[model samples]
Target chain A: MTRLRFAPIPAGLPATVPFTGPETLERRRGVPFVARLGANENGFGPSPKAVEAMARACAEAWKYGDPDNHDLREALAAHHRVAPENIMVGEGIDGLLGVLVRLTVAQGDVVVTSDGAYPTFNFHVAGFGGLLHKVPYRDDAEDPQALTAAARDVGARLVYLANPDNPMGSWHSGALIEAALDELSADSLLVLDEAYAEFAPDDAIPQIDPEDDRVIRFRTFSKAYGLAGARIGYAIGPAKLIAGFDRIRNHFGVNRTAQIGALAALQDNDWLEQTRRNVGAARERISAIAQDNGLTALPSATNFVTIDCGANGDFARKVLAGLSDLGIFARMPGTAPMDRCIRISCGPEAEMAAFAEALPIALAKAREV
Target chain B: MTRLRFAPIPAGLPATVPFTGPETLERRRGVPFVARLGANENGFGPSPKAVEAMARACAEAWKYGDPDNHDLREALAAHHRVAPENIMVGEGIDGLLGVLVRLTVAQGDVVVTSDGAYPTFNFHVAGFGGLLHKVPYRDDAEDPQALTAAARDVGARLVYLANPDNPMGSWHSGALIEAALDELSADSLLVLDEAYAEFAPDDAIPQIDPEDDRVIRFRTFSKAYGLAGARIGYAIGPAKLIAGFDRIRNHFGVNRTAQIGALAALQDNDWLEQTRRNVGAARERISAIAQDNGLTALPSATNFVTIDCGANGDFARKVLAGLSDLGIFARMPGTAPMDRCIRISCGPEAEMAAFAEALPIALAKAREV
Candidate 1:
């Protein structure tokens, strides 16, 4: 029998999930997690208005979503004070990253990202046959300077930096990012991922011009907007650069309900402000819980708190395993010394209470191990 | 200011929408179409149960969807009597097609399809640098033999055939497709798009083993199931070929509500059967409407009817324009001989009555033109 042939890039790729989903773990263990504090998902949930909008949209589920994403993009543009042409809505930040990588990285192209940063970005780069150059994080923050240097040295096509970074929950100021942009190679594109920007301090986001051709920024409704399951996000960049996405993006990838829900979510500023306060309070509580367990929690500007186990990667892994065993779903960084920390997402008071209750036992188990 | 460099393939491709959405036209005209009968969407709407499921899922929208799509894939596998490994769910059939093309079609790779067949498929192939070979329709139906012959001659990597073809709404017997498989080159993969299979006769869909490596079949909830706005679809193929998708698919691309909505839609077979009956009745009514205008309505195995305008492509364009002026959204094939007809989708009695009232005026306008 003749065998089907896949392109060399995909054929050689290891079948891997960039991040293990909480649901997958539950299915494997045959039990639901007690506190779903992993995956950095917003647990306070979408604005009540967004939920109502989704319910309303469900009635019109027969019509395919507007392929142009006109209304959503227009609304986003108004919110951002940018031209609609500067925004391209997509399935989510992950989906946008995939398309961005496909649009820039050809076989044997070079890409730069901090070591153990967003693994999904690496997955996309590798899927398109781009060679990745890893720059070690500088003091647990995504070292934008090192990333820029690596891009310049390798003549990389793309460089990735996540502000208010994931796993570590550390952030860089807007001034630092603007300075890093000056150092970014003209030929290279800086993929500034601001998925967690909504949770970050205002100064953490650089006031870059929407038409900055050298940089593309991704923001998502999945994060602070609390619509991760809706799979809605957008890239803000120069008109010419943004137009490149139209050449290859799944135009109608954003669902109708997602569009409606996100629009409603954007309109509900009071709910967003309330969720931000909730996340801030939750983060403090998580830090306090970590301190109680004799762990040092990293200062976080995002929704999640990354707690240092005050031990090695192995010890941290043990603690994470113990937490899993205790039915609390939390995650850790992929590489050291970041791997010495376990990340926990903010959630409702009950979930936080569950985490608070489980932490001590998980720590004791890790210590015994 | 420094400019960023894009991959040659995307940079060279034109920024064009493969199809102009109805919303775009509405925006352009500054008014919504009175009867949306253009995009082949099920105007009868999704099963009420699916809408309820979506509304329910909206409450839990903060959680990211299961990246593996485990439950839905498992359910779909059971529904198809295939193993879960043989199935891959995606944002939509359009999304799946984009990925499948990316997986197999490298730059300059040859792909064969019927002329004026699914422009989005051609758009994807071109976006990925695949050379497209178009075979003219044989008697308004996609000529499977011609497609196979073209694939063989071009050493194509992929061949696309939409059974119960779109735009023209023509179809072939399942035995014919099975026989045409013999004519297909051993090395080429057949992309069997059965988006309308739910509306087709039994003989129109061949009973191929799910493990068949030479072919991959795509089905969607967008048609008779009436969940197009949910943006969910799946591809069935051999496990090996299906696994290739894992290397590049946006793991959590399928929205949580979409997964819930589609699953609920699938379980409501009564709604589907009723939808089929409604579509059949609508098709007959459309044919009568065409007869009233002294035009010929092509027999359709799908939810839409393609009516020959009883004149040339120019005349059909005028008729379509007149319909648009009369606030009825309709579309026609983009390429030659096929463009001589206009396509209208199935809708409720009110929409059908609107079409009936408007057809004669549109025809008169076309005659005057």
Candidate 2:
């Protein structure tokens, strides 16, 4: 056998996937998913204007995108009431997280996050050889205080917190995040992921100064803007931190169509308001379905709802499997207490109807199992 | 000021750009270029089918792309007559090179490449803290033998060689590469970048077993396929080496429109054939333009022609500046010998005519300078 040399860090790391996409599952099951509600994606899709912009951008696909991402950053800055110097656009939040981890975390460096928080972030931390210090979620919500305390205790260089957190779909106010920032170690940068901030309540996102070097907030076009497939996101932070991204980022990584699509999407606030209303209705329907099936749905500020199966992790896993078997795609958290609930994403009426029809059968099957 | 902590590697690296994109130049000059012939992008654009496919994919933009890239990978595998396991898709060759460097190169590890060959490759190596050992180009083409010698001497973990070399538009036969492989150190992995392979001579690409653990081949949709803005590229290597990407890659990184567009682009062989012919004609016109200006155009196997300005590197630099002032975007290399030549990418007739009209005026300006 030829000796192939992979660096010690990657060689020791296990080949793992953070989340299996719906397409993979469909291929494995030899059937198309009746309702694609597993991944937290907007089913109403992007605005007609954004779609038209992307379609138009396709003809100009031969030209490389602007490496500086000036227009997109300027537009994003205007939307956020921040200067362009405070923003950096990248492939997506997932891609940006990887770059951020690469920028801050070194081998064996300490990093902190909620135990069952976004696994992709954890995957990035591990990929960079960061020693992860995980704190347990508090009552389904990621405890900002606990995360900050852990970061300080561990002398972590970075701490990750996702407002309107994934898996459990719970959120804390911006003031809570600011308080957590105060508690963080002086040297520890708080990575505040607000990927779902658009769908979140107004108060859920606190007004933090972009000049604060202690915190960098992430937002994506994938959620309320409804351009998940475009793979575009941006980070807002101190000018110095944003400049540092230039030293290591794939400068032309953002797709040109994505930039154009996102720009047009940002301009279409009417479409955004309509989608938010639609998602609110869909979330309520999902909650009703859970209630009818004798389960309790956690109050959500994002596009997904996590329902307590009124049992252990095993029962919840069975419920998820039952949903999968009935052609309804759903997901559960990766860790303990959180695994007691199954998560469902909001979609259009047809998809919600499919999930509603399967929920009772799935619950019955889970009880039998 | 708040204390910000970045990793030791990034902190030590300089914030330098690999290429100053045309958009950046346009913004700086306060005028758009009449002919955008820099950056080596295919100006003839992607196939209409690809454009149609991308436009169609916009409606389905709600869904995240398959994390596995299953369909695209299968299509690429079939095209290459290799198993899907042998391929790994990424944002672009530039993005993949960064990941590849992260996977194989630790701090202070030795990496070999031709000096002034591809600045982006060097940028990736420097970003990852790899110690680069650069061998100068021989006769405007990458000297594979010298690269292998340097790798053996330095005990390099990786060796990078671009087959149809960039900037100079020169190439080496596949047999020469095969011979170089024999001389490479047993433990060193060769990264053969074939970004411009489609436009090269028939003998320039050698047949190699997909299971060859000693080599990894990179191909991009950016050049001949004209999807640079889409940022899709794939690497073919042994299954083990390819699996290593899973340990650290942004799994859902590739955009959905890119996947759809590239698949359609790959299927349109007639479009590719027409493009190849167009590129050939454009190269000839570029050569004629150079000859008309009392310059020697280098024999090119790629989509661009490098014209010797009949003086030194300074003269060529002045010519490039003159072109820039005349609203014609063109590029020259960074190092000696290669720096004496200005590189111009092949484009449509209108762009070629614009360059043709501006070449003499630019040459006269350079002479006055």
Candidate 3:
């Protein structure tokens, strides 16, 4: 029998997990976390309208959803004031990113991203055999200028930047991103990930010409809209580029319930505002706690806050372990100085109270370590 | 701005839509299908437990689903009586195929499948730049011997076959498949898709050795289980191949609602049995309707029946259009011989009566054409 051999490209990559899901840890430890902040999930929960829509759709679960995603795409287009052809709703931003990479990238094509940017994007680039050139983060935020420069240097076809980014919960303002756009070579496409955009300040979102084929923007209902479990997100770009998704994407990838839930979530802007307020208050409380423990909290735009322990990455790791031992699940960045900050998602009072109860002990334990 | 260059591989394929969904046609025609017998969807709906679970889980949709899919995988592992390490769940069979092809097929690699097999799988193979080698169906059923010989001759990395197949609604029994397996090389992975396994006769399903790495089997909730909209499907194989998914799969691809929905669907065997009964009745009625219309119905082990229109592909296309005109949506195979048959899904009285009403008109229309 001939032995199966993986392609040379796939063989080059190590059998490494893209991200460790919190559920895996819970199963291994035989205990669920009392407060789950590790994955940057919005513990605030989805809107009542979204919930109602999903619950109501339950009875008709047998029917396959409209693969064209007419309702959701139409709603999204209206929301963004763009034509329906310029929008493509997918399983999630992650799923959409995979497809976008597939369309443009071929073997050994150059792609640029922040050094510790969203690992999933890197995973997709590598999955398609793209050669990734990473620029280092500046002050825990993605340096858009550097990303653009790297793209030019590598003659990269795509450049990715997650505004109000994950892991560190830091953001680059809309103006900064818009300014950086001019630096990108026309051949180097810009992918502005606005997954956390709904939580950003009003001025933090960049205004791009929807017809501009050189740049594409990604948004999600995962954070402020609170429908991550529904697996719904979308990308906005030039009609031609957006339509390219039809060539290879799983047309029926986004579930019907998810589409309904996300549309309802988007319609209830009041709920989004409330979640933002609640998340802001929680972030403040988290910052105060960090300050009390002699640490510094990074300025944040997303639902999660990253706290600097005023020490090395190892010390922050100890503190994170201490919090985990106390049943508060939080995470930290993977690379360099940014790793010194521990990330905590904003949830309700119960999670806030859990953090308050655990932090002092974690700080003390970290001192002992 | 410089125009984005699509990869050479994608350029080879047309901007073709493999499935023209009922919704698209409805919107284009400005009316809905009174009976949707097309696409082979299980019209019986999902289990009561699954609906209730999803309903109850509505609010918790804020949280991202566990990327590792711990709970569902554990449940699936226990159900299959295999180690959890052997199971890997993705968005659906479509997503899994995308990942599998990425792993095995580099540019110009050979892939083998039936001429009129699942178009989506062929789409994925083409998307990944694999050179597809097609073997035509023999006797209205998947020709296992031809597939086996072709895989070995072509040194194909993958060969796809759906037992109780799609479009033509045909099947080769479990013993025949097992016999065919003995002739395959290790390099050629037999992709045994059991998406409609639950609907198949008990004797039609072969007992598989999960430890045998030569084959990867896929199971889904989209058919008899009635959770197609949930976008959850799993593959079972050797741990080594299972672990390979970790290298590139979007970790959080499967949503929480999907996991919950599928889990609840799997737990309720009563609902599955009920759906099977209903589906069986529907299939018989559809077959009877075909015979009444002067057509010969092919044998089926699925939740759909393929009716021979007793003429050429053109006649079948006219019949299909006639059904569409009558607001009864149905489809037919694309290739020759098979295209002579019009396909109708198993559904309740409402849809079946519509088919019955529309069949005579469609036949007359075909004669006129």
Candidate 4:
């Protein structure tokens, strides 16, 4: 018998991490990456204003962050043109998702997600002892209508859909997502994770009433805004559900430096636009490179490109391993059909050049496998 | 009827917050205090090296921090003379508390704490639908003997005790705590929150087998190292229990700047020692100030001193508000007998001088009240 025991959920929880970070992979390999393009982190960097703000705040690191997050909330409210009550800032969308899961899910409670959706969300559901039922994606695209039906079928407490979804860099427009929201079953709360929302086209986000309670939208500065390291994000929903987060959240989970950096970042619209433009250019470059290598790249509205590897799961795994051998850090989809694709993040020109140079050798090695 | 509603447990949760930060209180009072000596935050500041590290790290703010916190965990492991598996870094003790509560506490599970202990712990229990019971502090300190009995009586899922306790600043020697550990009931998991352990005497920390799993200890850089703004702290326990955090924790919850800043802070032993000395000296100054006003200051081993106003709760509140009015931010305990004391954090010479200059006026105002 194990001398020490954990509570049931944690006891049954396999010690499997949601994702093995590239740094861990590097440590195991004993070599750092030549081109770090995985995880969809913005390589364009944060606004100088944000950097300066953090630098200035560093001297005052002895003080805890303002627990209320008043300044940042007010600033986010002003920037998003929404009331401060409509926004709940947190450690990141990852942190916000955990709280949402706790609020809605109980032991054996039903939850729904796309089979190949964000693994972190699945981790939360399983961690909470929620019975997770996954609907398969239709052609690497999240079938929202099917997801809604599954929620009704299972009588799920929550349904999650990530727009411009990760791993595949696929998307459906705001109009379709709004239609999906309308189709959601009454008993099910919709968690529309828009972590990559800022990178999508202007019309991609639905113009919903801020007071609507059926869905809570998760947004983060981690993607196109290039503040991933800051660990700051916000959720927008009706005050009733939003207030529930305050009941369970780590009040000071968001660092004081993050609060200061995010506030500064939200103010620098010029830098955001420039970064978005850079992402667009990099996507085009990556797409062209994929085409030259005889791989089909998915049209993306995200900060990364997911290229179809033109083979089965094993073949794609070989390609991924080969890339790792070439000192290029990239990732692939966890589930098949989607597994026949490899994802690459936008990076600086130097890193992009490294990717272009490394692809042919990596592909040849995959063929040998 | 509400179209969207949370589970009954979540809906039942209060909108109550933990501690109201000084910033919030400042905003409420329509002015910022010149001397912020509230919340027990270290005012001596983080190590200069940490600030320099943060400034250098600013350019890469766009990249996501290592989700595994690899380098940081390695450094901390070396510092504590333990394996990396023994430590689980988090946003702070607050974040870890939330996770631990979720892992062990289910609806109606019994959780025990001191009557006037950290309110945040009570808040988490309530959020998780746990039954919360409190034991009164015996003779102005947390009585481990009572705590053990309460845990056994309630069959508590968890029992918490903070060494060099917050709000009170009293401590028990490690020998006493170690003795208490043996008497602790097996049903309840013992949580020794050592947030202020650095301020305690050398013998105050019990050295147990690092491989032991029945108890967990949490430590933070927020106190003596003065890096509260970085939001970094850790829980050390058995490998199995420590690894359990991955199943429930937000893998990327900790911020990048925090990792960089805290790593540098940990290496600066000189700064840590100097800050401890500064906090000690300032504690003496604060005690002297309290005695000057004809009140008794409780003996403290932490960064803050709790002064008995020697009057009723009403008198203490009046004095706290008066201090606020005089641009000095200080707090008082929430309960009646403890409310007879007002808490003040040790700070820079300027802030301490401000407290000394303002105490008499505040006391006079309190007397009139």
Please report the candidate that would top DockQ against the real structure: 2
Task: List candidate 4 stretches off by more than 4 Å.
Answer: A1-3, B1-3
Tens-digit lDDT string for candidate 2 (A1-369):
244768889988988879889999999999999999988899989999999999889999999999888898899999999999999999899999999999988899989999999999999999999999999999999999899888879888889999989988999998888888888888799999999998899999988999987899999999998889999999999999999998999988989999999999999999999999999999999999899888999999999999999988999999899999989998999798889999999999999999999988888988886
- When sorted by DockQ, best at the front, the candidate numbers are 2, 1, 3, 4
Docking quality (DockQ) of candidate 2: 0.75
Superior candidate under TM-score, 1 versus 4: 1
Clashing pairs in 2: A174-A206
Worst 10 residues of 4 chain B by lDDT: B1-10
When superposed on Cα atoms, how far off is each prediction in RMSD?
Answer: 1.1, 1.1, 1.5, 1.5
Which has the higher DockQ value, candidate number 1 or candidate number 3? 1
What are the TM-scores, per candidate, against the unseen true structure? 0.99, 0.99, 0.98, 0.98
lDDT of 4 by residue, B277-307 (tens): 9999999999999889898999998999999
Candidate 2 DockQ category? medium
TM-score of B-chain for each predicted structure, in order: 0.98, 0.99, 0.98, 0.98
Report the C-alpha displacement of residue A364, candidate 2, in angstroms: 1.1
Clashing pairs for model 4 are none
Q: Model 3: runs farther than 4 Å from truth?
A: A1-3, B1-3
Model 2 has fnat of 0.81
What's the DockQ of model 1? Answer: 0.74
CA error at residue B179 for candidate 3, angstroms = 1.0
